[model samples]
Target chain A: MDDRPGAPRQNASEEIEALITLMAKLPGLGPRSARRAVLHLVKKRALLMTPLADAMHNVAASARECLVCGNISGAEVCHICRNEKRATGEICVVEDVADLWAMERAQVFGGRYHVLGGTLSALDSIGPEDLRIPKLVQRVADEGVSEVILALGATVDGQTTAHYIADALEGTGARLTSLAQGVPIGGELDYLDDGTITAALRARRSF
Target chain B: MDDRPGAPRQNASEEIEALITLMAKLPGLGPRSARRAVLHLVKKRALLMTPLADAMHNVAASARECLVCGNISGAEVCHICRNEKRATGEICVVEDVADLWAMERAQVFGGRYHVLGGTLSALDSIGPEDLRIPKLVQRVADEGVSEVILALGATVDGQTTAHYIADALEGTGARLTSLAQGVPIGGELDYLDDGTITAALRARRSF
Candidate 1:
């Protein structure tokens, strides 16, 4: 018997094993935790367990990704893409679907989003074509998008991707903006570098 | 036009609304977060979304409560109940199935579990019948269980339920043993009341 981390237990059903495998892949969870979680969901079938399972099934049957902006949807285009009111000549570009949703939860941005799936990573052999950069450029022209807000992370890859996108959209006459840096977010001001502080200070306008 | 939190936009579907409603009820999730989670799942259908949904549907269709111990199951009795190896002389009793699973994760005990479902609570109109006390007693005799280990919480209702079960099982030839109480379990021990401390001390024996 192999002693690998999260190895499948002997004599378990394929379905149960599959559940354990998938659950183990979830963030902050492992094989042991997955087993425990699956057991729990199975036990609370009427109240919590069933509903969660039903939700998973319904989503499985209907879920699809929006080809235009990389947002997940039940159809070819997501609800955000279908909404004419959201087409406000501005596109907020994000690094991941989760980040896009986080922005949506704030309810401050009235414009729609374009998910990049991930930032530029030379180490990972990821190039511009690997991301949704081409589609974003196509959207700028087709949708008459005026402003592109870069909501990438502060990481090197995130900055590189933001710059790459900024350069790509230069000919389209679309203004590029990014989320502010060097702010004491969640009370972690002490972690800021001098470069970040300097860049934030230089970028500071009237606001 | 209600001002309540998490009110969906007028264009959202009833199914989507229902999904959002149920998602909102989940632990660590609220209405706004639920909306975002649903959106993310729907979009990632082929990868992150569809499989999750499929798993949910399968579980939902087959899930049922174990008639014997109130554990979640896909049949008349749970896997624990069906397993012959688990029919040891000792039964580890718990306030809920979650607690039962916690003990299982620890893997110290080889005996079966008795899920009381919940603790005794006067504030919520809960009583012995509201729990699985009667079923537990019956099982002790029917299964020839020699020892009944009480692994309930140290809360007021938890202690009350434990004592109630101890009294009910008197002279049934089943030795009742509660989990130790000296340690600051579920919290630091200094926070416990003097009466609880005294009782725990009196109940203490040679390890």
Candidate 2:
């Protein structure tokens, strides 16, 4: 009974312990996994750990948020914003940089992106001014954007923010569209929630 | 579908791409998780990413394997090897540094450790010389050790290494013991493997 695998230990060196502590604060890693990861990193120093350290150092020194779209980049303007080929007069709005990256991975949207950082939260006292909403409005007018895609989440805050943006861009004369809600790919209708089923039913289309 | 998540994109900056590539190479992480982790790191650069980078740099610069027992530390001799209080006559031999760290977490073993790096693998052509077995033998003879506990796995390679160590230490006058095999706490007999069930039966105690 004394051999619990993940009990905290004070025997590790200060740097290793510190590294594990920081690593455990990451999104999916816990303390036990952090310990295992640190061990792996140290054992493969030449192949992985050192390179990762160098990469992080470089990023910490050079990485910046794009002044135009709020995407992260090494330059003031992100590559997507600077790329002339992607200047298709369309802007996709997302809540965070992770969502922007996810959209990029899909490669479905061939235009630029605007990261709002987070949605407006009344409880948190967040307003449109706190986000990049004003910048987005300005971008729509200045860039002659033809379409504005609101790819926000289905949460209350996300919807509230989407409606607020729609109102703000009312006079900008840009067409606005939000992603459709329904059963996801490979999802079974029987297992779907009532709300999704209703949305899917309402949004039914002809083949 | 043109929406493959991991299709290589030239949009990401070189350093960020490099970091994600290395992170994906970790034992428990994949491309998607690595991308998420990198995005998290970039967003929290001031608090988490900077500190993690510094800690990695420090550990990479100073961490060294213990000359005596193979434990990792900032010093030539690890803290466990240097600690006078833990100089018990017992030595626990393990397959890797992670296992050594796991034992330290248990805090029950008041003895030092010998990390074998890996178990014997005939298919991989791993002989005794590939491990720290020779150093362990020397330590047993020179340190006046009383017992050598084999805290290795019950896998074929683990058993093979344990038996090989035992044969090598036949005349070393140290008591040899392997970890006991039995039903684990909170385990069900129905779900237990045949080998484990047989071992548990053979080692059953009478009330």
Candidate 3:
């Protein structure tokens, strides 16, 4: 059906269409935005498009999951995992590497991290074995970790995963804890939901 | 000034950061959305990231502007310009290749096109010489184009460019015309701007 009597029409060249289609696959970009991005890239072929293409190529060739923590890094083991000073006897467990990066951006935790990759989900048949849970358990025992902070989300699956990990490491003698749920800093009490208000009141401390 | 005493901390590896920075430069993608996109790309490295990178590289290497019409294509000339059946003695002028693609999508015009590259701008110091005005004149003369339709925007610069081209092609014997100024299809009169309403009223047609 190369050129039938009534073949489907194409808007632009196949190469441009292919670029737009792939651009649409990225997070937060739809078909319309992908088309706009493609046009913009074509307009700035040398300055933006070629450099972006090169960057994507380099990242694709080099980026790999850290063997120790599951965070995406340029090396087999990420910088945090390789840093001896970051081992601080604590490993913050997060559901995704994005969350790990978020924590790092805040510069709050000095210890290393263990990305769970995902929380337990019975509906999707995702279990502890499916994620980095086993590796987390092994790290706790081998590394003599003193504390395992569950910085996972407050969703039901997140809590279930946290509790499951706590039970899994019962004999490891590591102190297990989770992030507190409450009114966020700079949050208005009037805007908060009842659950948040209740949690903040229950976890309240002296002024 | 890397690793100096109290240097600024970085959240992710340099490669990942570079990818995010480049991604943020894309249209409709800000820093936050770019970070999310980079994370998604990293997670699907083999499936999506590699293919996208390859696509971009190929497009960047192969894509070129059509020598005659200024449309981006893999070949020296675009399919539209090369299609003998599309030589309908009419040339539709547009502001950009994106607009040319839009016209192709509509599939209303059955003739060739001329991409003006950009509109005339006095504030930005853009002149007729900066655009494809000379080339359009040569095309109108050499290609024996009978009707030159100006499909530029309603903006001041777009109108100014259209008028300039009209004056430039006065003795070329090509009938100079423009897209009708009216309320757009599916547009409400109440929601329309004053200038559009005035134009529509002045150029009103009989039922």
Candidate 4:
């Protein structure tokens, strides 16, 4: 006999539990959210879950990192790296694939991208060799890149990586620049942080 | 040349976009969260995404509704309905499969469940026939059920449904009861609504 007072005699099947565990590991999801997502998927299996499964299967089997730029793709090289029209002698550097995707969403930069994988972190024992900095320098030299845009974050590690990249590419003659810091569009001054306010003030322009 | 200022030369591949669209439609996910989940899945394809895909495929292919109850399962009758040890002479009625799952999570209810799918809503033109009421009545008469626990929400439609079920079961010997309304565990009094406080006060038991 089951000892628990109100507990169900049986729990969810092992397969379901395994799926929920894996889902909980996803970004922005915890155990509760994962359980909810799995239930929703199960309820809409025919309409949503089956198609999602197929898509995941396809991507999992085919997805690979671009050899030249490190962006994710179904081929040896990502589309952005292969696009001749985007070979505009400029390469935007970002920390991770998510940032690369974000830059793609903005649709502003017209050149290619080089994903650094992560910033140089001393605490984590990450160094220049751990990242794609050497490959970036090589790309700049081989591809005759005119500029390297460091679109890194304002965090300490981000700044450290940016400076390191600048020093690494000093002799390569490729002009290096970082994204300008300022108040975001539609941002309230009262809510703005001191660093942002100071940066906005320093980079202030005539209206 | 691409006309968009900062837009990527190309958007995500068709398969990826399809996956993102389906993911966005899930209960807790939106477009941005869906994108992040998809990217995380892509990055962890070997360890997480592949297994998740397989689990979903298996569940999608085999999952079905219990014939006796409306709970989701891999079998026709579901494990709970088939378990003879769980025949506790009680049926906890709920509005949806999610509610059933929640009750199961609590591990308090030891009886079977009858999912109503939805409440009787005059505003939405939903009547007793639209839900599993007739089936529930048939179950109570045929299955030797003694008690019917109404685990439905504390809404007007829920109360209306409970009363309607009671009326239907008047000839039968099944006793009907609803979940007690009260302030939830760890819930702040300041945050609780008037109705909850009143219910908690009215149902107060001696120490």
Candidate 5:
């Protein structure tokens, strides 16, 4: 019941507790799971903990957001932003660096990317100035981009951000498009959301 | 589908991927959650990642299994094993160090512990020799322990290990006892399994 900051949680050692608290701060992890992870790591200190710490420290010291695209990169600009072959007059806009990486994992996109960092959210008070919207607009104008594909989430914030960007780039001669919203590959109708089912029906194509 | 060791994983950087791969090796984490955790860590390198890495490295170097009881501790012998006040003529045996910590969190037992490291499993080729069984026996004999408590799991292997230890400790004049099986605190009867209900009924206490 002690709610004071840094209160001891009956952990064995201060070092272990500190490590567990930090691990708990990570996304998708809570105190119990963090403790479990720290125990697992400690049990395999030589085989896993040391190497993981070394790798995390190296990344913490070296990883930087790409200066141009806002993607996480070791260099000032990411390889995708620097690669000339990817400058095919098409640019994909994603809400987060994770999304950009997901797109890359698909290996279907050969164009450049602009990471929005996060979508606009009125509830959260996040506006155009809060995100990389200005930078994205500047990139579209300067890179001779012909198409700006919004590969954002299907959430309300994502749709609003896409609309805002489309409006901002009006008359810039760059075709504004968003990713088609339909049932995902391997998706089942039973598990699909109502919005998705409606969108799939609206955007249906000839088989 | 490429199962090659250290195969590239389409990550933005090798350092990031290495950290994620190590994280994925944790007990409850998967590749997706590891990537999410790494991304969250990278985003807060200054606030969380660097300190977590430092803590992990320190624990990796300093945290050693207690020479006597196999409990993880900063020193060669854990604080619990060396403490003079906790010699309550009782020793609780647990399957893992996590179980030891859980017992400590309960703060009810004023005794020592013997971490088994793992239960005896014929399927996994693990025997009592692989655990700290001989050490427990030596401690019981040298320390004049009056009672040995088994706070192990309810599973088949846990029962088998407890029975094996009980058989080994016979004729030593020490009382052998295992943790009681019953409905957990705040447990609903509807969710109770048949075996647990049966055990609770057999071990019923007068109201």
Candidate 6:
């Protein structure tokens, strides 16, 4: 009778409660919404549901972080790192793999990617070691990367991280450039359309 | 160099590419957007990334469908259906379990629910068996039901399903009612805000 599942409980199955709890934890989905999503998935089991479950299961089982770029992968090296044709002298530096994928979808960037994971934030006490900065530097040297394109956020911390990376790679002989200032502050590259990303890449400025 | 992974024979370690591909398949996410999401999750590994991964893994392993009402439940039956207090001699019959959960969020519907799975769509060749209509009928008889409230969509298919059920239950002593006609055509109950749902429930009409 008590709507609260936390109450000394009734005859409910533990698995059902567990499923609801997990669905409730998802972004934009609360306990109520999670219940709805679960219901929808079950009813449409043949079309949308089964495929989604399989995808989730497969991804969950095989997913791992890329050692080189912190990108999601099924194996050790991410696809971007393994691809030979994508190994242009240019390496597009992004704060996240999502941005890298966005670039790839636009089909403009022929080069590889360096996912920084996140920008330096003093408030968050996040430093270079917390991200993939060290690996990025090593990649430039090990891969003969000629240019490091910075497609980071315009936030203060993002700018600060960019400057730090530029300083660290000063003698690496790789041309350091950044996406144009056109990217608004705290504006994630994910929200930008293909044209905007292209323009930003085309009008890159020297760091 | 070639960004495409599943396109041909190659090593399967392309984590970034795999992540991007998987992400691209998410609802409201394309190849480009999935890439961005993966990148962001990787960057915020500690704060956002790790937590999300753990959550996904947990849900992936345990999530399942409820046997009774067809809601997402970790166990055989959903929490709502198991609670004795929820057995208020009234059952709100909805086209989908999502509708049931939406009603729950309003904290107005104290009774149990019957998830029909979907409306009877002739064009789609969806019949009573195709949905959980038979199950709903069985539940009404088994649960000592008083009122069978229909919270179906305003679409033609939804109306057809409602009429079919009403006709089927015509001789039954239980009363048949439906949510007000104010609900828009082809409108999903999930998209409506709480107030609208409350109004619709309060202004319900006889079938």
Candidate 5 chain A: worst-modelled 10 consecutive residues by lDDT = A1-10
Candidate 1 lDDT over residue span A144-175, tens digit each: 99999999998899989988998899889989
- In model 4, what lDDT does residue B126 have? 98
Q: What is the TM-score of each candidate against the true structure?
A: 0.75, 0.91, 0.88, 0.93, 0.96, 0.64
Off by over 4 Å in 6: A1-13, A23-33, A44-70, A79-88, A134-145, A180-207, B1-89, B104-112, B122-145, B154-160, B179-207
Model 2 C-alpha lDDT per residue in residues B1-207, reported as the tens digit of each score: 322456755546778887888888877777778888998898888898889888998888888899998988889999888989889999999999889987887678999999999999999999999999999999999999999999999999999999999999899999999899999989999999999999999999997
lDDT (tens digit, per residue) of candidate 3 on A144-200: 999999999988999899999999999999999899899898899999999889989
Classify candidate 4 by CAPRI docking class: medium
Q: Give the Å shift of residue B70 in candidate 1.
A: 2.9
Task: List the candidate 5 regions with Cα displacement exceeding 4 Å.
Answer: A1-9, B1-9
lDDT score of residue A51 within candidate 4: 90
Fnat, model 4, is 0.64
Model 1 chain B weakest 10-residue run by lDDT = B1-10
TM-score of model 3's chain A, to 2 decimals? Answer: 0.94
lDDT of each: 0.74, 0.89, 0.88, 0.87, 0.87, 0.69
Best by DockQ: 5
* Candidate 2 C-alpha lDDT tens digits along A131-165: 99999999999999999999999999999999999
TM-score of 1: 0.75
**Candidate 4, A1-207: lDDT as tens digits:** 222444334456656766777888888888778888988888888988889889898888888889998988878988888889899999999999889878877778889999999999999999999999999999999999999999999999999999999999999989998999999989999999999999999999999
Q: Is the docking of candidate 6 incorrect, acceptable, medium or high quality?
A: incorrect
Runs in model 3 deviating more than 4 A are A1-7, A185-194, B1-7, B183-207
lDDT of 5: 0.87
What is the full ranking by DockQ, best candidate first? 5, 2, 4, 3, 1, 6
lDDT of 6 by residue, A75-135 (tens): 7777777888888899888887556655665567788788887899999999989988898
TM-score of 5: 0.96
| Range of the 10 consecutive residues with the lowest summed lDDT in candidate 2 chain A | A1-10
Candidate 6 chain A worst ten-residue window by lDDT = A8-17
Would you give me the overall lDDT of model 2? 0.89
